[model samples]
Target chain A: MLIPGITIKKGVCQLLALNKFSVGQWLKTFDTIIFDADGVLWRGQQAIDGAPDTFNALRAMGKQAFICTNTSETSREKLCAKAQDLDFLIAEDEVMSSSEALARYLQQRKFNRKVYIMGGQGIADELECVGIESLPLDEGKMIGSQMVDYVKNITLDPQVGAVAVGLDKDFDMLKLAKVGCYLMDPKVLFLATNRDHSFPVAPGHFIPGSGAMVAAVESLAKRAPFSCGKPNTFICLHLLRQGVIKPERTLMVGDTLYTDIQLGYNCGFQTLLVGTGNNSLQDVAKLQRSKLPLMYQQIPDLYLPKLSDLLKFLPSRNC
Target chain B: MLIPGITIKKGVCQLLALNKFSVGQWLKTFDTIIFDADGVLWRGQQAIDGAPDTFNALRAMGKQAFICTNTSETSREKLCAKAQDLDFLIAEDEVMSSSEALARYLQQRKFNRKVYIMGGQGIADELECVGIESLPLDEGKMIGSQMVDYVKNITLDPQVGAVAVGLDKDFDMLKLAKVGCYLMDPKVLFLATNRDHSFPVAPGHFIPGSGAMVAAVESLAKRAPFSCGKPNTFICLHLLRQGVIKPERTLMVGDTLYTDIQLGYNCGFQTLLVGTGNNSLQDVAKLQRSKLPLMYQQIPDLYLPKLSDLLKFLPSRNC
Candidate 1:
């Protein structure tokens, strides 16, 4: 929560104008800073340079800094190990992941059901951690069938209640056909982990995220599922539950305006835009000229080269 | 030509609703029959089992059968080779691909300028064949780079005149970035080959068809491109040029109600829904429940199980 150089008077104006300087002031002002890992701290293994210094600066100011990554690839312990390797102090509770959020949400809801999953082990593990049985394969000959097939095949059974959609590697024609069939029954509740089309690029190349699979099934069944991560308000609620952020005073900073900035806008928090991630400035300008939501343009109170650039405006005392 | 067991009658309705005995009476009713290859005679490969017999039956009746496909994959020669393998006698000019339609439309418009293409060889070849230069790759320094990195990056060129979007495997982030940057200039005209999300299942896994890349760039740019294929009346106009089938008398047989039926309706052709491929019965049923476009649920005059199902309705002489 320490900004390195700005005076208190300058900090006040920064917050009011909500400019890039104000974002740095806000980062210094808060006791606990939550960072979205992908765009904020790092993209895959290559850490965003200055991420460690920023976190170290926060700790030097006697504030708590945590990484809230949407990635389900790493467990909390692994994340802590990575954080330590990056020269930052991180604890299990200080790290919140979509996988963990999904697990917690499922446990709290106590929706006793068998989730027919079309995703990765992270999704299945999350469901199982909540004491829910996970079914990975199609049991009722719904495979390779159309929407009407569900009514004829699986909906008759009370055991089959909900369908969970996520990134499924081996998901092919049979899985898609089955998901489409199952979705049309109307009795089954559908849940999409996230609606991202492509995740952050890594050595493996860009893989199709959950949204493509979700989109394929959604288009066929003509039904939208309950999305539960990133831009979804549910993730914001999870952040609030951890007592890490006060909605009115918090700021969400990231490279993508649609997800990170939009999340901030929805949560009544200030936002900062970094121009180095999923979307480009030209895309933003295009949206500005068209039917893009007004709140989207207004959502980001600041624009910075990257999250690290905020350091320059930090209050000297806080640093 | 043969419509399963139905007979043609004195009028259009009578011709559509007649039984096998009366089919002989309607044999001489229509002078031309147009077929869509993707869903009718064959799907990617391995012809529809009963296609050869149906074509032979129609040939016996002395009906002019024309194969009109929305595919951009094959040229007239390749299409003929495939049809021959399926035992259907098709002339080179009798088959019309959407690529040809796009070529003709572009040639007639006489743009006579460079086109930044993101499609197959068919599109590139068509443009070249019509004396137009293809300019798909990045030309020079892109506009909107606030920094002087443009001076260092040779890939960003500003000389592109137009962008034509079609199916291509080379569609990647760099291409999209270039397109986005070029589009920001406002002088580049945008064109899309088609708007289908997924094509028929081929030997390899489902490739990201043109529409996928189109949607990605379109979402960022927030603009609709000029469609040059099915559901767009341009191709229908091309068919009308050859005096092959009177627009009013033509029957468009396709499995997809959206593209095929919509194209048929737009072209003033009676549409026959063949539900055994691509779209299913429930897909149609869903449209019936909504206030969709007229073509969505204005039930086709005939519902054939497949293109082969039409064999039952052909005149006895045709069979």
Candidate 2:
């Protein structure tokens, strides 16, 4: 039976049953695919079944696939290593993590400002890869000790022109205070990796994510940082502008709608939602019935129970 | 010349010129006085001249005075010691600090749950004084390291019935996450000492105050702590209910209108704004012209340059 009110093939047509739309149907119109990792390709560190085979089959079909994740902790090399270890066939250059996007965005600008980071070693490594220096990660600990006296002790360096915050284990008052100090100077760029408030670590457990840490800094700084993640479109659009990817022919696939599907919505690309992650098809159907401000949030173009379901959609039995 | 539009007396008559309306007149109505320490009685650690003498004079006039401060770091004994060093004599029992108020608030209920403290030694001392145990101040640090994995690692002691925040010199993420873990129980009391965002350190310098720290925790916990400071009236009224003071016969004096004067407004006590610390006469006059939502922000009942000015209002005073 069809799940009524689902979005597919765009003109607001009567939607078909869930998973009825095939990858062969999606591939007919789209040549490039961008995947959100946590839900689509894998959960935590585990590779979802049929994921690697689907990507391997897509490559055999002369299609391009890229990993576009908001995971700020892992470096590009690490992401590629994880994919390789999981037997997912993807090139290292094809992985566009939020940390890498931040690095590329800064690299494009030739940003000279020594950055103060409120993130993990991945961002530090990426920033260093581009020759943009970031302040010591533990600087928050040292400066925060003196913060009890005055913010004066946590002074901003004249060259520190940007403050980048991502998922960090060391999210503390010192880093937050240092970020607040630099933010006082109006010239500094406040770059945040993403706005995800919480994520599932295990099936039953949820912990505060980067969005929570970013908000703590944002609250004190009285400013919002521009996120370099999915919804921002800076990552994929950067590739599109270079003529490597065409928005009209690209499909953005993910488990979550707000970040993954909205990112596709933002970039004017076709979006596919899979139920193997944070959001499910029922959640989307229920949202469509309610009042939500963002148009992108109300629905996704097409959704499947899992990425592996697309395997059945391939027209060729060889697929 | 008197500052026009200032609040004075019960009839709301134009405030008299400065301290021109003698203490002789203030004594005729308000027999008991509550003082905010930082700006009203002293700036930083220095006491204003004639502050002790005025208190001594009020004592001689058969009046009652109480020190109601939000200084969380200092114990009641320390407050008395500081008063002694400043040449002011006050009974230890009469001192009501935020830490002490929290102690009494917990004591009244006979809370069996151990408390998590995001403050200094004084609150810890005060809690122990009332037979309530507090977790180690650095417990946040120990538990916070495991937060990256899961909030479950930051175990909430079944006995930790409350989390109280104040001006902690060692504010960090670990402490915030721990506080958040305890707050998840919903039954845990979220107690904050005060909500002072910043305080004047010297002539022109200011430091991030306890309010900033409290806000960080409040943001993560998704709740506001019950403030046990001057403006909240929890402390003042707690004593009032015990028959230790009467609101009708009391005057609340402070330098800052928000914390000090608002405390009086909340408790229905006469309020006097002193200029020697912060929120000068000109500042109040400026705020009066602008529309304000809170009644206390409209105007205080009176204004004086400093506490010493009250010495001139003393009856039968000898040079």
Candidate 3:
């Protein structure tokens, strides 16, 4: 059903429901497709029904398919393995996780010093992939009960040049204190994987994301981190810079509005919102009614129940 | 020296330097005095010079002095003991800590459920003192490597009704997760000790305060906590309600502007800023020049190099 009262302006179709005809026309508009992993393709360990076939069909149609995920818990290798296990056709390098984006960002800057990581081993591995060294995560955990003694004896590694933050189950006060100490020197770079506040674990159940960890360190460090994930444009800079994907011909598909839709809007890509994830048509309608121009950026150009629904609209596929 | 550009209003004096005569007049203006312990009376374990004698002299002259501190790391009993150790004539009941204030807040509400504490033992002890039970601080620490397993096995205690956050060296993601889970039930109260971002440990050295812990949980919980510490009128409500102190005749003294002076401004109490703590005369001068009406609330009515400076100006004490 088409959402009522949303007027489509030139070059932007706000909350237009995609039918077979519209989907076919939409498919012809984008040569490159960026997919958000968690919500659009799968929910946790389970892939959205027919999502793999839809993704494969998109690639088979000569469209460049790239998976851009905000999850920093795993590296691209692991993400590729996960995607393959779910029967999606994917190349390892075509996937850009926030961790990978942050690693590339540091690599591009020629950052040579050791990193103080307040994230999981995924970030550490990504940095390692770029030949960057990170301090052992266990070193700061030895801060015993005596905070004063710990502060007095705290020896900041002079070689440490950056603090990379991501989602970590092991996040604690010791890490926060160490980050604060390192950040006291104005030269130390503060970087975050993403600022996504929370992600769904189950229906209506959400857990704290990397934003929580970043906020904690931010409170202590008294500074903001250079975020590399959506809606930050830094995540797709390499693709844009290398002319791999022309923005106008690219379609960004995801469930979340703030990250996926906003990123697509910022990058001048056509955005498709899928119901299998965080936001819904109702949310789009609410944003539409609010009349805030900023919120309008989060309203996707098209909407679908799930990514797999597009499979029927593919010209090569039998309805 | 008097702040040159500042103009003294009818009721508010912005950064008037306290000299012998002005200090005597200032002493006569307030019948009750509220002192901030950390920066005003002492820094770390060492007592600020002449602070104890100055405090005692004020009490000797029939002024009611109370130590209203934002430190939630210790109970009132411990605070009184520390004050006594530093040669201040402080009674156990005369000290009001953020922890104590939070405890009273819950007690006043007749809160019966167990508190999920994300703070030090001080908060737990304060809750216990007010006949409230808190969950064991170590229960959340046993969350092992597998977050999925932990989340799947997570059992929130039905009795837990509130999450009290303060400075905890042991603060971790597990606590944040638990708080997130508990807060999913909107009826659960979220309380914070204070929101002071950082506190001075030594000259030019600072450490993350309770605000860091609060910010972490806040990011996860997606709601602001009811802060019971300085600048929140709830902390001083009991004294004000009981007629123990009149706001106009009460002087709030401290080194921090945002907390102490802002609290004074909020409570209609005269504010005194001392240089020995987080803020200084320069900060006051800067605020004075900002011309923003809100910033003026942080500009103290009186200024002194240290709390002990008032000792020389007390009429009862010979210079």
- Find the candidate with the highest lDDT and give its number: 3
Flag regions of model 3 displaced more than 4 Å. A1-19, A139-144, A203-205, A285-293, A316-319, B1-19, B139-144, B202-205, B285-293, B315-319
lDDT per residue as tens, model 1, A1-319: 2344644331112233345654554565456555777767776566788877766766666766666656653455667777778777677777766666666666777778666776666776666666888775442221222322322333323465677776554444445544555555687778777766654343212444566566655655557877777677676586677655787656666666666767777777666566556655565556656665563443355556666665555555533
True contacts kept of 3: 0.44
Report the C-alpha displacement of residue A200, candidate 3, in angstroms.
Answer: 2.5
Choose the strongest candidate by TM-score. Answer: 3
Chain A of model 2 scored by TM-score: 0.88
**TM-score sort, best first:** 3, 2, 1
> In each prediction, how many residue pairs overlap at the backbone (N, C-alpha, C within less than 3 A)?
31, 3, 0
The lDDT ranking, best first, is: 3, 2, 1
Cα displacement (Å) at residue B186, model 2: 3.9
Query: What lDDT is reached at residue B58 by model 3?
Result: 89
Which wins on TM-score, candidate 1 or candidate 3? Answer: 3
DockQ of predictions, in order shown? 0.06, 0.23, 0.45
Q: Best by DockQ, which number?
A: 3
Interface RMSD, per-candidate values to 1 decimal: 13.9, 4.3, 2.8
Predicted structure 3, TM vs. truth: 0.90
